[model samples]
Target: MVGGIAQDDARENRLIDLFNLHQAADRVRHGTDAILKLDNVEYEFELKSATTNKGGISTVRDLGPGHIAKWRGKHWIMAFFEGSKLLYCRYGSPDAMRPWITEKWDYIKADFEMAKYVPAHITLDTMFEIVGKKEVYTKADARKIHKNQMSAAQYETAQDTVEGYSPARMLDIFKDRARYVIERGSTLNNPHIPSKYFESWPEIRTNHAAKLRELVSTWRDAKP
Candidate 1:
Protein backbone atom coordinates (compact mmCIF):
# COMPACT_ATOMS: atom_id res chain seq x y z
CA MET A 1 0.00 0.00 0.00
CA VAL A 2 2.85 2.43 0.85
CA GLY A 3 4.60 1.67 -2.43
CA GLY A 4 1.37 2.30 -4.36
CA ILE A 5 0.87 5.62 -2.55
CA ALA A 6 4.46 6.62 -3.35
CA GLN A 7 3.89 5.86 -7.03
CA ASP A 8 0.72 7.95 -7.03
CA ASP A 9 2.59 10.88 -5.45
CA ALA A 10 5.33 10.61 -8.05
CA ARG A 11 2.73 10.65 -10.83
CA GLU A 12 1.06 13.71 -9.31
CA ASN A 13 4.40 15.53 -9.07
CA ARG A 14 5.13 14.79 -12.70
CA LEU A 15 1.76 16.16 -13.76
CA ILE A 16 2.33 19.31 -11.72
CA ASP A 17 5.73 19.79 -13.29
CA LEU A 18 4.24 19.41 -16.75
CA PHE A 19 1.50 21.89 -15.96
CA ASN A 20 4.04 24.44 -14.74
CA LEU A 21 6.05 24.02 -17.87
CA HIS A 22 2.95 24.57 -19.97
CA GLN A 23 2.05 27.68 -17.97
CA ALA A 24 5.58 29.02 -18.36
CA ALA A 25 5.30 28.56 -22.10
CA ASP A 26 1.92 30.28 -22.16
CA ARG A 27 3.29 33.21 -20.17
CA VAL A 28 6.15 33.48 -22.59
CA ARG A 29 3.77 33.47 -25.54
CA HIS A 30 0.56 35.19 -24.34
CA GLY A 31 1.84 37.43 -21.51
CA THR A 32 -0.04 38.05 -18.23
CA ASP A 33 -2.07 40.87 -16.56
CA ALA A 34 -1.48 39.84 -12.87
CA ILE A 35 -4.95 41.11 -11.88
CA LEU A 36 -4.27 40.69 -8.20
CA LYS A 37 -1.46 43.23 -8.37
CA LEU A 38 -3.37 46.16 -9.85
CA ASP A 39 -0.52 48.58 -9.21
CA ASN A 40 1.81 46.47 -11.24
CA VAL A 41 -0.67 45.77 -14.04
CA GLU A 42 -1.11 48.15 -16.97
CA TYR A 43 -4.76 48.10 -18.03
CA GLU A 44 -6.67 49.20 -21.15
CA PHE A 45 -10.29 50.38 -21.20
CA GLU A 46 -12.70 50.03 -24.15
CA LEU A 47 -16.35 50.76 -24.64
CA LYS A 48 -18.88 48.07 -25.29
CA SER A 49 -20.17 50.07 -28.28
CA ALA A 50 -19.12 52.91 -30.58
CA THR A 51 -20.84 56.18 -31.47
CA THR A 52 -19.79 58.53 -34.27
CA ASN A 53 -19.76 62.32 -34.45
CA LYS A 54 -19.94 64.84 -37.31
CA GLY A 55 -16.16 64.87 -37.58
CA GLY A 56 -16.29 61.09 -38.21
CA ILE A 57 -14.76 60.51 -34.79
CA SER A 58 -16.08 57.43 -33.01
CA THR A 59 -16.63 57.35 -29.27
CA VAL A 60 -16.86 54.20 -27.20
CA ARG A 61 -18.80 53.86 -23.97
CA ASP A 62 -19.22 51.06 -21.43
CA LEU A 63 -16.31 48.82 -20.50
CA GLY A 64 -16.15 45.24 -21.71
CA PRO A 65 -15.67 42.59 -19.05
CA GLY A 66 -12.01 42.14 -18.01
CA HIS A 67 -11.16 45.46 -19.70
CA ILE A 68 -9.26 47.86 -17.41
CA ALA A 69 -9.05 51.64 -17.75
CA LYS A 70 -6.01 53.74 -16.96
CA TRP A 71 -5.04 57.38 -17.36
CA ARG A 72 -1.82 58.34 -19.09
CA GLY A 73 -0.39 61.85 -19.40
CA LYS A 74 -3.22 63.36 -21.48
CA HIS A 75 -5.42 60.49 -22.56
CA TRP A 76 -7.41 57.54 -21.24
CA ILE A 77 -6.17 54.13 -22.37
CA MET A 78 -8.43 51.10 -22.43
CA ALA A 79 -7.26 47.57 -22.98
CA PHE A 80 -8.23 43.95 -22.31
CA PHE A 81 -6.33 41.26 -20.38
CA GLU A 82 -4.83 38.22 -22.02
CA GLY A 83 -3.92 35.78 -19.26
CA SER A 84 -2.46 38.23 -16.70
CA LYS A 85 -1.03 40.87 -19.05
CA LEU A 86 -2.69 43.65 -21.02
CA LEU A 87 -3.44 42.59 -24.58
CA TYR A 88 -1.03 44.31 -26.96
CA CYS A 89 -2.47 45.52 -30.27
CA ARG A 90 -2.75 48.70 -32.31
CA TYR A 91 -5.44 51.12 -31.17
CA GLY A 92 -7.24 53.49 -33.53
CA SER A 93 -7.75 56.25 -31.00
CA PRO A 94 -6.43 57.55 -27.72
CA ASP A 95 -9.54 56.34 -25.86
CA ALA A 96 -9.94 53.04 -27.63
CA MET A 97 -9.70 50.07 -25.25
CA ARG A 98 -9.44 47.26 -27.70
CA PRO A 99 -7.20 47.22 -30.71
CA TRP A 100 -8.89 47.50 -34.09
CA ILE A 101 -11.61 44.85 -34.05
CA THR A 102 -10.24 43.31 -37.23
CA GLU A 103 -6.78 42.45 -35.88
CA LYS A 104 -5.99 38.77 -35.13
CA TRP A 105 -5.38 37.89 -31.47
CA ASP A 106 -2.35 35.77 -32.32
CA TYR A 107 -0.74 38.80 -33.97
CA ILE A 108 -1.58 40.96 -30.96
CA LYS A 109 -0.21 38.49 -28.39
CA ALA A 110 3.18 38.56 -30.08
CA ASP A 111 3.89 41.81 -28.19
CA PHE A 112 3.54 40.47 -24.63
CA GLU A 113 6.27 41.38 -22.17
CA MET A 114 7.09 41.49 -18.43
CA ALA A 115 4.29 42.75 -16.13
CA LYS A 116 4.33 46.33 -14.87
CA TYR A 117 1.62 48.28 -13.06
CA VAL A 118 0.07 51.45 -14.41
CA PRO A 119 -3.21 52.80 -13.00
CA ALA A 120 -6.09 50.72 -14.39
CA HIS A 121 -9.87 50.26 -13.87
CA ILE A 122 -12.09 53.30 -14.05
CA THR A 123 -15.88 52.85 -14.42
CA LEU A 124 -17.23 55.98 -16.12
CA ASP A 125 -18.34 57.43 -19.45
CA THR A 126 -15.10 58.82 -20.77
CA MET A 127 -14.90 60.89 -23.96
CA PHE A 128 -11.96 60.33 -26.27
CA GLU A 129 -10.95 61.85 -29.59
CA ILE A 130 -11.09 59.31 -32.36
CA VAL A 131 -7.83 59.23 -34.32
CA GLY A 132 -9.05 58.78 -37.90
CA LYS A 133 -11.10 56.60 -40.20
CA LYS A 134 -10.14 52.95 -40.41
CA GLU A 135 -8.73 52.24 -43.84
CA VAL A 136 -11.01 49.96 -45.84
CA TYR A 137 -9.12 47.84 -48.35
CA THR A 138 -11.10 45.90 -50.94
CA LYS A 139 -10.38 42.26 -51.73
CA ALA A 140 -8.79 43.26 -55.02
CA ASP A 141 -6.62 45.85 -53.30
CA ALA A 142 -5.52 43.23 -50.80
CA ARG A 143 -4.62 40.86 -53.63
CA LYS A 144 -2.62 43.56 -55.41
CA ILE A 145 -0.76 44.35 -52.16
CA HIS A 146 -0.04 40.66 -51.68
CA LYS A 147 1.23 40.36 -55.24
CA ASN A 148 3.64 43.15 -54.56
CA GLN A 149 4.82 41.45 -51.37
CA MET A 150 5.24 37.91 -52.82
CA SER A 151 8.53 36.40 -53.96
CA ALA A 152 9.08 35.79 -57.66
CA ALA A 153 7.99 32.14 -57.41
CA GLN A 154 5.02 32.95 -55.16
CA TYR A 155 3.90 35.68 -57.56
CA GLU A 156 4.16 33.26 -60.50
CA THR A 157 2.06 30.66 -58.65
CA ALA A 158 -0.60 33.25 -57.80
CA GLN A 159 -0.86 34.44 -61.39
CA ASP A 160 -1.10 30.85 -62.60
CA THR A 161 -3.77 29.99 -60.01
CA VAL A 162 -5.83 33.00 -61.04
CA GLU A 163 -5.52 31.84 -64.64
CA GLY A 164 -7.01 28.42 -63.64
CA TYR A 165 -3.76 26.47 -63.27
CA SER A 166 -4.05 23.51 -60.90
CA PRO A 167 -1.54 23.78 -58.05
CA ALA A 168 -1.92 20.01 -57.41
CA ARG A 169 0.76 19.42 -60.07
CA MET A 170 3.53 20.26 -57.56
CA LEU A 171 3.79 20.71 -53.81
CA ASP A 172 5.74 23.94 -54.23
CA ILE A 173 3.01 25.28 -56.49
CA PHE A 174 0.33 24.25 -54.02
CA LYS A 175 2.17 25.86 -51.11
CA ASP A 176 2.86 29.01 -53.07
CA ARG A 177 -0.76 29.30 -54.14
CA ALA A 178 -1.81 28.93 -50.54
CA ARG A 179 0.62 31.66 -49.44
CA TYR A 180 -0.49 33.98 -52.25
CA VAL A 181 -4.13 33.97 -51.26
CA ILE A 182 -3.87 33.26 -47.56
CA GLU A 183 -0.78 35.24 -46.58
CA ARG A 184 -0.39 38.01 -49.16
CA GLY A 185 -4.10 38.79 -49.46
CA SER A 186 -7.50 37.34 -48.79
CA THR A 187 -9.03 34.78 -51.16
CA LEU A 188 -12.58 35.96 -50.80
CA ASN A 189 -14.85 36.24 -53.90
CA ASN A 190 -12.44 34.68 -56.39
CA PRO A 191 -14.52 31.81 -57.83
CA HIS A 192 -11.63 30.39 -59.82
CA ILE A 193 -9.54 29.72 -56.68
CA PRO A 194 -9.34 26.04 -55.72
CA SER A 195 -11.58 24.52 -53.05
CA LYS A 196 -8.64 22.70 -51.42
CA TYR A 197 -6.80 25.98 -51.03
CA PHE A 198 -9.78 27.50 -49.23
CA GLU A 199 -10.31 24.43 -47.03
CA SER A 200 -7.24 25.19 -44.91
CA TRP A 201 -6.81 28.80 -45.94
CA PRO A 202 -8.31 30.32 -42.80
CA GLU A 203 -5.97 28.41 -40.50
CA ILE A 204 -2.90 28.78 -42.68
CA ARG A 205 -3.43 32.50 -43.23
CA THR A 206 -3.47 33.35 -39.51
CA ASN A 207 -0.42 31.28 -38.62
CA HIS A 208 3.22 32.27 -39.11
CA ALA A 209 5.14 31.14 -42.20
CA ALA A 210 6.82 28.30 -40.27
CA LYS A 211 3.41 26.90 -39.38
CA LEU A 212 2.22 27.21 -42.95
CA ARG A 213 5.37 25.39 -44.12
CA GLU A 214 4.72 22.56 -41.67
CA LEU A 215 1.14 22.24 -42.84
CA VAL A 216 2.22 22.21 -46.46
CA SER A 217 4.87 19.57 -45.67
CA THR A 218 2.28 17.36 -43.99
CA TRP A 219 -0.09 17.73 -46.92
CA ARG A 220 2.71 17.00 -49.37
CA ASP A 221 3.82 13.89 -47.50
CA ALA A 222 0.23 12.61 -47.47
CA LYS A 223 -0.17 13.08 -51.22
CA PRO A 224 0.14 9.93 -53.34
Candidate 2:
Protein backbone atom coordinates (compact mmCIF):
# COMPACT_ATOMS: atom_id res chain seq x y z
CA MET A 1 0.00 0.00 0.00
CA VAL A 2 2.90 2.34 0.61
CA GLY A 3 4.91 3.74 -2.30
CA GLY A 4 8.45 4.90 -1.54
CA ILE A 5 11.67 4.04 0.28
CA ALA A 6 10.59 2.78 3.70
CA GLN A 7 14.00 3.22 5.29
CA ASP A 8 17.36 4.62 4.26
CA ASP A 9 20.20 2.53 5.75
CA ALA A 10 22.92 5.04 4.84
CA ARG A 11 20.97 7.73 6.67
CA GLU A 12 20.54 5.42 9.67
CA ASN A 13 24.32 4.77 9.71
CA ARG A 14 25.07 8.50 9.70
CA LEU A 15 22.63 8.97 12.60
CA ILE A 16 24.38 6.28 14.65
CA ASP A 17 27.77 7.83 13.89
CA LEU A 18 26.57 11.26 15.00
CA PHE A 19 25.10 9.85 18.21
CA ASN A 20 28.35 7.99 19.08
CA LEU A 21 30.35 11.13 18.31
CA HIS A 22 28.35 13.32 20.74
CA GLN A 23 27.22 10.93 23.51
CA ALA A 24 30.18 8.54 23.71
CA ALA A 25 33.35 9.32 25.76
CA ASP A 26 34.93 11.21 22.81
CA ARG A 27 33.10 14.51 23.50
CA VAL A 28 33.61 16.96 26.38
CA ARG A 29 30.86 17.15 29.02
CA HIS A 30 28.93 20.36 28.46
CA GLY A 31 25.40 21.86 28.57
CA THR A 32 22.28 19.92 27.55
CA ASP A 33 22.81 18.80 23.96
CA ALA A 34 20.03 17.63 21.65
CA ILE A 35 20.32 14.56 19.43
CA LEU A 36 18.58 13.71 16.14
CA LYS A 37 16.53 10.95 17.91
CA LEU A 38 16.69 8.24 15.28
CA ASP A 39 14.77 4.97 14.77
CA ASN A 40 16.97 2.91 17.08
CA VAL A 41 17.19 1.79 20.69
CA GLU A 42 19.10 3.82 23.30
CA TYR A 43 20.41 2.09 26.42
CA GLU A 44 20.58 4.51 29.37
CA PHE A 45 22.82 3.73 32.31
CA GLU A 46 20.75 4.32 35.45
CA LEU A 47 22.26 6.82 37.84
CA LYS A 48 21.29 7.62 41.43
CA SER A 49 18.37 9.86 40.37
CA ALA A 50 16.01 9.31 37.41
CA THR A 51 15.26 13.05 37.05
CA THR A 52 18.89 14.12 37.13
CA ASN A 53 20.17 11.47 34.72
CA LYS A 54 19.26 11.70 31.06
CA GLY A 55 17.25 8.59 30.19
CA GLY A 56 19.09 5.79 28.40
CA ILE A 57 19.29 6.49 24.68
CA SER A 58 20.29 3.47 22.57
CA THR A 59 22.33 3.94 19.42
CA VAL A 60 22.28 1.60 16.46
CA ARG A 61 26.02 0.99 16.90
CA ASP A 62 25.95 -2.83 17.19
CA LEU A 63 23.78 -3.25 14.12
CA GLY A 64 26.15 -1.15 11.99
CA PRO A 65 26.59 -4.11 9.57
CA GLY A 66 23.11 -5.75 9.85
CA HIS A 67 20.01 -5.36 7.73
CA ILE A 68 16.67 -3.99 8.95
CA ALA A 69 13.16 -4.89 7.93
CA LYS A 70 12.19 -4.25 4.32
CA TRP A 71 8.61 -3.30 3.45
CA ARG A 72 7.28 -2.80 -0.08
CA GLY A 73 10.92 -3.09 -1.31
CA LYS A 74 12.03 -0.32 1.02
CA HIS A 75 14.39 -0.86 3.97
CA TRP A 76 13.27 0.01 7.53
CA ILE A 77 15.19 -0.59 10.72
CA MET A 78 12.91 -2.48 13.09
CA ALA A 79 14.22 -2.46 16.69
CA PHE A 80 12.91 -2.79 20.22
CA PHE A 81 14.21 -1.23 23.44
CA GLU A 82 14.11 -3.49 26.47
CA GLY A 83 14.18 -1.77 29.87
CA SER A 84 11.99 -0.02 32.43
CA LYS A 85 9.75 2.81 31.22
CA LEU A 86 11.17 2.77 27.73
CA LEU A 87 10.45 5.61 25.34
CA TYR A 88 10.82 5.16 21.56
CA CYS A 89 11.29 8.26 19.46
CA ARG A 90 11.68 8.77 15.72
CA TYR A 91 12.72 11.96 13.95
CA GLY A 92 11.96 12.30 10.25
CA SER A 93 8.97 12.57 7.93
CA PRO A 94 5.54 11.12 8.74
CA ASP A 95 6.50 7.75 7.22
CA ALA A 96 8.94 7.18 10.07
CA MET A 97 6.11 7.60 12.53
CA ARG A 98 3.78 5.12 10.88
CA PRO A 99 5.25 1.81 12.28
CA TRP A 100 5.16 3.07 15.86
CA ILE A 101 3.71 6.48 16.65
CA THR A 102 0.57 6.66 14.55
CA GLU A 103 -0.12 2.92 14.62
CA LYS A 104 1.17 1.69 17.99
CA TRP A 105 0.37 4.45 20.47
CA ASP A 106 -2.67 6.30 19.13
CA TYR A 107 -5.06 4.26 21.30
CA ILE A 108 -4.95 3.02 24.90
CA LYS A 109 -2.21 0.63 26.14
CA ALA A 110 -4.77 -2.13 26.39
CA ASP A 111 -5.51 -1.31 22.77
CA PHE A 112 -1.89 -2.19 21.95
CA GLU A 113 -2.90 -5.83 21.77
CA MET A 114 -5.28 -4.79 19.04
CA ALA A 115 -2.58 -2.52 17.64
CA LYS A 116 -0.62 -5.62 16.74
CA TYR A 117 -3.39 -6.30 14.28
CA VAL A 118 -4.39 -2.73 13.35
CA PRO A 119 -1.99 -0.34 11.63
CA ALA A 120 -2.15 3.40 12.23
CA HIS A 121 -2.93 4.31 8.64
CA ILE A 122 -5.72 1.70 8.63
CA THR A 123 -7.30 3.22 11.71
CA LEU A 124 -6.89 6.72 10.36
CA ASP A 125 -8.24 5.67 7.01
CA THR A 126 -11.20 4.02 8.72
CA MET A 127 -11.93 7.25 10.53
CA PHE A 128 -11.60 9.37 7.41
CA GLU A 129 -13.68 6.90 5.42
CA ILE A 130 -16.55 6.90 7.87
CA VAL A 131 -16.81 10.67 7.99
CA GLY A 132 -16.46 11.08 4.21
CA LYS A 133 -18.84 8.23 3.47
CA LYS A 134 -21.45 9.62 5.84
CA GLU A 135 -21.36 12.93 4.01
CA VAL A 136 -21.60 11.10 0.71
CA TYR A 137 -24.51 9.03 1.90
CA THR A 138 -26.22 12.05 3.37
CA LYS A 139 -26.17 13.56 -0.10
CA ALA A 140 -26.71 10.31 -1.99
CA ASP A 141 -28.37 7.38 -0.20
CA ALA A 142 -29.49 8.89 3.09
CA ARG A 143 -33.16 9.32 2.19
CA LYS A 144 -33.57 5.85 0.72
CA ILE A 145 -31.70 4.05 3.50
CA HIS A 146 -33.66 6.17 5.97
CA LYS A 147 -36.99 5.14 4.46
CA ASN A 148 -35.99 1.50 4.40
CA GLN A 149 -34.80 1.69 8.00
CA MET A 150 -37.80 3.56 9.45
CA SER A 151 -40.65 2.01 11.48
CA ALA A 152 -44.47 1.84 11.23
CA ALA A 153 -45.40 5.08 13.05
CA GLN A 154 -42.59 6.95 11.32
CA TYR A 155 -43.59 5.52 7.93
CA GLU A 156 -47.24 6.44 8.53
CA THR A 157 -46.42 10.11 9.09
CA ALA A 158 -43.89 9.98 6.26
CA GLN A 159 -46.47 8.73 3.74
CA ASP A 160 -48.31 12.05 3.29
CA THR A 161 -49.47 12.00 -0.34
CA VAL A 162 -47.36 13.93 -2.81
CA GLU A 163 -48.58 13.89 -6.40
CA GLY A 164 -45.98 13.06 -9.13
CA TYR A 165 -43.23 12.50 -6.55
CA SER A 166 -40.39 10.32 -7.86
CA PRO A 167 -38.67 7.61 -5.79
CA ALA A 168 -35.67 9.91 -5.44
CA ARG A 169 -37.92 12.67 -4.11
CA MET A 170 -39.56 10.25 -1.70
CA LEU A 171 -36.17 9.17 -0.43
CA ASP A 172 -35.09 12.76 0.11
CA ILE A 173 -38.18 13.33 2.24
CA PHE A 174 -37.48 10.18 4.27
CA LYS A 175 -33.88 11.22 4.84
CA ASP A 176 -35.06 14.64 6.02
CA ARG A 177 -37.35 12.85 8.44
CA ALA A 178 -34.40 10.84 9.78
CA ARG A 179 -32.23 13.95 10.01
CA TYR A 180 -34.99 15.69 11.98
CA VAL A 181 -35.17 12.71 14.35
CA ILE A 182 -31.41 12.85 14.82
CA GLU A 183 -31.34 16.62 15.45
CA ARG A 184 -34.20 16.40 17.97
CA GLY A 185 -32.52 13.35 19.60
CA SER A 186 -35.79 11.51 19.31
CA THR A 187 -36.10 7.76 19.74
CA LEU A 188 -37.72 5.94 16.85
CA ASN A 189 -38.16 2.37 15.60
CA ASN A 190 -35.55 1.45 12.96
CA PRO A 191 -33.13 4.21 13.77
CA HIS A 192 -30.79 5.13 10.91
CA ILE A 193 -27.91 3.38 12.65
CA PRO A 194 -27.42 1.17 15.65
CA SER A 195 -25.78 2.36 18.89
CA LYS A 196 -22.29 1.04 18.10
CA TYR A 197 -22.46 2.21 14.50
CA PHE A 198 -22.30 5.78 15.77
CA GLU A 199 -18.91 5.13 17.36
CA SER A 200 -16.94 4.55 14.10
CA TRP A 201 -19.70 5.35 11.58
CA PRO A 202 -18.56 7.46 8.66
CA GLU A 203 -14.81 6.92 8.95
CA ILE A 204 -14.90 3.23 8.21
CA ARG A 205 -17.47 3.90 5.49
CA THR A 206 -15.27 6.55 3.91
CA ASN A 207 -12.14 4.36 3.72
CA HIS A 208 -14.17 1.63 2.05
CA ALA A 209 -15.53 4.18 -0.41
CA ALA A 210 -12.00 5.35 -1.13
CA LYS A 211 -10.86 1.81 -1.75
CA LEU A 212 -13.73 1.49 -4.21
CA ARG A 213 -12.67 4.70 -5.86
CA GLU A 214 -9.12 3.47 -6.21
CA LEU A 215 -10.31 0.19 -7.66
CA VAL A 216 -12.45 2.00 -10.19
CA SER A 217 -9.50 4.13 -11.17
CA THR A 218 -7.36 1.07 -11.56
CA TRP A 219 -10.01 -0.61 -13.67
CA ARG A 220 -10.27 2.43 -15.91
CA ASP A 221 -6.49 2.51 -16.32
CA ALA A 222 -6.46 -1.15 -17.23
CA LYS A 223 -9.22 -0.74 -19.84
CA PRO A 224 -8.21 -1.30 -23.45
- Provide the TM-score for each candidate, comma-separated: 0.18, 0.15
**Each prediction's Cα lDDT score?**
0.27, 0.29
Q: Write the per-residue lDDT of candidate 1 for residues 17-121, one digit (tens) a residue.
A: 322211223432113311111224322222111111112222223212111223121112112223333232112122221232223223323222101111122
Residue 140 in model 2: shift from native, Å? Answer: 44
Question: Best by lDDT, which number?
Answer: 2
Clashes of each: 15, 16
Runs in model 2 deviating more than 4 A are 1-7, 21-224
Off by over 4 Å in 1: 1-38, 44-170, 183-224
**How close to the true structure is residue 41 of candidate 1, measured as C-alpha lDDT?**
31
